[model samples]
Target: MIIFLRRKMSRSKECLMKYNSKKALLVTGERKLKNTSEKLFSELKVSPFYLNQLSEVLPFLSRENVDIIIFGSDTYQTQKETFSELLQTVSLNYPQSESIILARENDVPFVVSVLKFGSTHYIKYPVGIKELQSLMKSAMATQPAISPRLEKEPGKDSSRFGLIMGKSTKMQQVYAQMRHAAMTDIPVLLIGETGTGKDLAAQTIHQQSERSAQEYLPVNLGSLPNELVASELFGHEKGSFTGATHQHIGVFERATEGTVFLDEIDSVDEKVQISLLRLLEQKKFNRLGGKKTIKTDARIIAASNENLEELLRKGQFRQDLYYRLDVFRITMPPLREKIEDIPMLIEDFLTRFNKLFNKKVKKLDPECLEVLQAYNWPGNVRELKNIIQRAVLLAEGDRLYIHNLPPRLQKTRRSAHSISFRIGTPLDQIEKEVIKETLALTHNNRTQAAKLLGITRRALYNKLNKHKLK
Candidate 1:
């Protein structure tokens, strides 16, 4: 009993020691920023130190160990040269410590410039606590030094990687991560909203990997029936079920020593997840109705349009399976986040569709481009491609015009009058005004007004009589 007590105490001490080892330093003079840093560091359970001036940073850092350094953009803007010097010093003297900058969204160009000086990452200003917490945690966990930072060579194009195209800083960051994932054989998880080029990213990772020589198979799990997902992933023996008249070979078996890209992995049911977990853990799985465990050397790259972490929290996804695939995770930025790359993307799409359709569309009208740029792309690059394809087919001359675009995109500005009411406006009064406007728009047609108001003609007549509109 005494021995057990001593061993438990020793284990607790070791755990405490490990937790205390991670330290962060914040160099800022702003009070709000200092308060935010305190709250963030406290939540992360990381020891933090602060300094008001840049001069004390190196001296303090040299005396103590710090794992993260965050420079305030407010102060960093004034002392750009000094900040650059400090970044160099940190990179050369403390390569293990990652540096981050807190800047506004408009400062992307400046952030991109500083990234070349060995800075690890940047966080946009006015970030919510939850969003900032996630970013800092990911930054703390990653080793940016080992991640490949691919730059444009003198003769090579840097705007594109494999089939993925973009020159924005966000896409460049993604490209670096893709290169990092390609260098290893570990399972990778690609997370993003739909139409974010996740499929392209998966194919790129495989093409850049050593498994390029082998076959690359892509499976859209969402498109398959839930009952057959396991069978499709792991081959079934003859006479295993009613449909199994002959032996079947699955992606894992056929893609041996290659790459298997699993799209919409979140749709996989719990039964299939169990088999996936086992395959990831042991690199082997049993075929349906077969007793033998077959070994596979294929690399797994899973992607999802939904947030798998959220699914795990809701108990919809298996925790073990999520972690198994999250060993190396890459997030593809939404089209809205990388809007700067849209013009280039538009050009590429136009070129492709022009040749295929045998059109001579040379350029987009300035007004049309403006409409496209101003609109929020919910469907992302895929949506833009579809729009361009349609426009090319409709365009009659050498240049595409605003009229050729979809009605949703053709309207550069909305002319509809916005109705505003005071906080104390009576509900009846507001309803009267809405009804009046509806009747005016319908040119005094009571039936049309009733339909527009989502009410029957009798109710409209009663209201009109009560309000004396008749």
Candidate 2:
């Protein structure tokens, strides 16, 4: 039995108990080991839930706010494969959890295996009660504190993730994936239609990643000339080619220890794809002219508007290269698919362009809002942003009216959705008509009508009562 001297603990029992209450899971198939560890923790006034099997560990980890994971060396020796998988999952998804391997003095084999799994804390048997207490404190100290901003609801001011903004279910999924991508340096491939914010997603991942402090270089591969793509990516030696007047450092070299955003990755020709595959595999490449193999620690994040899977089938994109880049895929949803986010997006854009153009365009006219929401945004967020910028620039008054939008968008305005009013009409009468039209549009579904009209359900009810349109 491990002895625990409560009076000798460096920290107070209350503090240790506070941390323990957050939860810890102790896994071991040996009943003796489980009982000993439990007694040790109990003496320190900490209680850890016990699991006998590695299979149970993952499910519990997923469902609970596990701060520390202590597994016996016996468990590791018997279930090496499962232990390794669990370590990987914990490292990637639940990064805040500290994994400690409990081993005996003679467990040299276990020590070797643990090293391959990365930095994991371990305690040998016959550990002093003070040492065990210290280890627990150290493990708890390593766990990162959750940011207050992240704890807020997604639709609140916290809706923005990096530069990308949306609270739609699809966008929330994207944000989660982006966070996962940022947690590692694995190659990320963003697939989406044009204007779906793939570029922004790549930038956001880099911004949120460990590599944020390093250079973030974005290259639009499709914008470069076919012959110049290689030289642009891998640099060129002086006089290497016709235009290589001086030695030029490429993205991979310049962004060493940083992130490289390869926008329009599908446009890369066969030759560039070969170079990319080699770079992804080896993280080393020779410049366009130089033969010296330069090693780089650059993280690759490639984005494509076109379907690369189809390109792979058509032999346009190399299969091996596709596989290498497809490690962490983030598919950005098109604007039309996330239509409910339009109002919020519009509000964001309005705030942005309002500052840029020195205009205070307060709100979109009811018809203008309806037209924008109804149109199939083929150009996605980028198109909407451009239209908003134009509208803000052309907006003559506080409200953004239909005439401020492009004629193409004007055509989308439905007659039934539009309300006509005389110049001298009372503001209250106009408000009543607008509410009546919105109710009809939503078939009297107050919740949705409130959303469309950009008001709380309570506020809409108040309006209905005031207008006698309830």
Top of the candidates by TM-score: 2
Candidate 2 lDDT over 159-223, as tens digits, reads 67889999776786777677657756789999999999988888888888767889999999999
Give per-model TM-scores: 0.60, 0.63
- Once superposed on the true structure, which residue ranges of model 2 sit more than 4 Å away at CA? 1-158, 418-470
Candidate lDDT (C-alpha), each: 0.77, 0.78
State, as a TM-score between 0 and 1, how close model 2 is to the true structure: 0.63
* lDDT (tens digit, per residue) of candidate 1 on 39-138: 9899999888998888888778657767678877776777778877777666544544667777777775776676765536777776666766776666
Model 1: colliding residue pairs: none
Q: What CA RMSD would candidate 2 show?
A: 13.5
